[model samples]
Target: MATKKKPSSDQGSSSSALDSSRWEVSCFWERRLQKELMSLMKEPPPGVTVDAEGAGQNLTQWIIQMDGAQGTLYEGEQFQLQFKFSPKYPFDSPEVTFIGPNIPVHPHVYSNGHICLSILTEDWSPALSVQSVCLSIVSMLSSCKEKKRPPDNSFYVKTCNKNPKKTKWWYHDDSV
Candidate 1:
């Protein structure tokens, strides 16, 4: 006796099911970010340490930490970084911000804990990874010749109505 095989209903469904087997149900970007995180953990940036924990009530969001490198005002200090991964992912960078009470009060960072980095904005490229962002922050801190916060940090953070997204950053000066 010969057995009959079940016929697939739709091409899209069949293709999607096959794809789902390889990819996860979670947002594609989150998976990509997680993979990047794992790679970074294997070889983390210099002077900075990081970890990711599931956010309360939201598994998609991760809580990260950035320990101040040894030679900056942020040195020896511990800061919490929040990373909210959107469905767009590698095409769109994560929404990251420095949180926690001990957050740095730097020229480029706001009191509310937002960071002003070019790579996080217009300079962002799909070629960039989470590790690169952390490394950039590390380099930014190391290059700070003045240990004081930007004279306008408070003003900019408080008064600037422009969204971090709307304001394109110009990273011309490495001097912080």
Candidate 2:
């Protein structure tokens, strides 16, 4: 009689891990997010234009240009938004922030160019896309009840961490 060998636990675990990783790489959320971002390059938001400045021949990093929506405080302003996607994206949200001089000195946006948004922070979900982020920012700029910063804007700006991903922001208002 020939003896049959059973697969070891280590081998099974490794195989399962690989499969999970492969599945993550091909996840529906990632595909949807990428598709959405790509579509924006072709047909952008109203009055907004985005150009991809390839970060070393890879599409991981993008410098997006958004022409502030009309009837907004940012009207006539062309803002630069930086988007950096990780390999484990959709699971880990992209690192997005305003870059360079075009950044608006708003209540929600810090002087260092970090944006304060719920979705970018504690409220992030795999369902959200780059288009949604942009739309949210546009809406943010559009609904400026006043030109001044929020009452706690100074403290938030000073104490806030430079890395948007690491910072946890509280979302108090959904109206804007």
List, in order, the clash count of every candidate structure. 1, 0
Candidate 2 local lDDT, 1-176, one digit each (tens) = 12243333332113345344443433443344445556786777775556643532455676778887777777788888888887667767889999988778677777677887888867778788777888888888888766666667668778977778887677777777
> What is the lDDT of every predicted structure here?
0.64, 0.69
User: Best candidate per lDDT, number?
Assistant: 2
Model 1 lDDT tens row, 25-143: 23455345555655665677765455543442353566667777786766787777776666677777767678788767666777777778877877778888777877887777666
Q: Measured by TM-score, how close is model 1 to the native structure? A: 0.72
Worst 10 residues of 2 by lDDT: 6-15
What's the lDDT of the predicted structure labeled candidate 2? Answer: 0.69
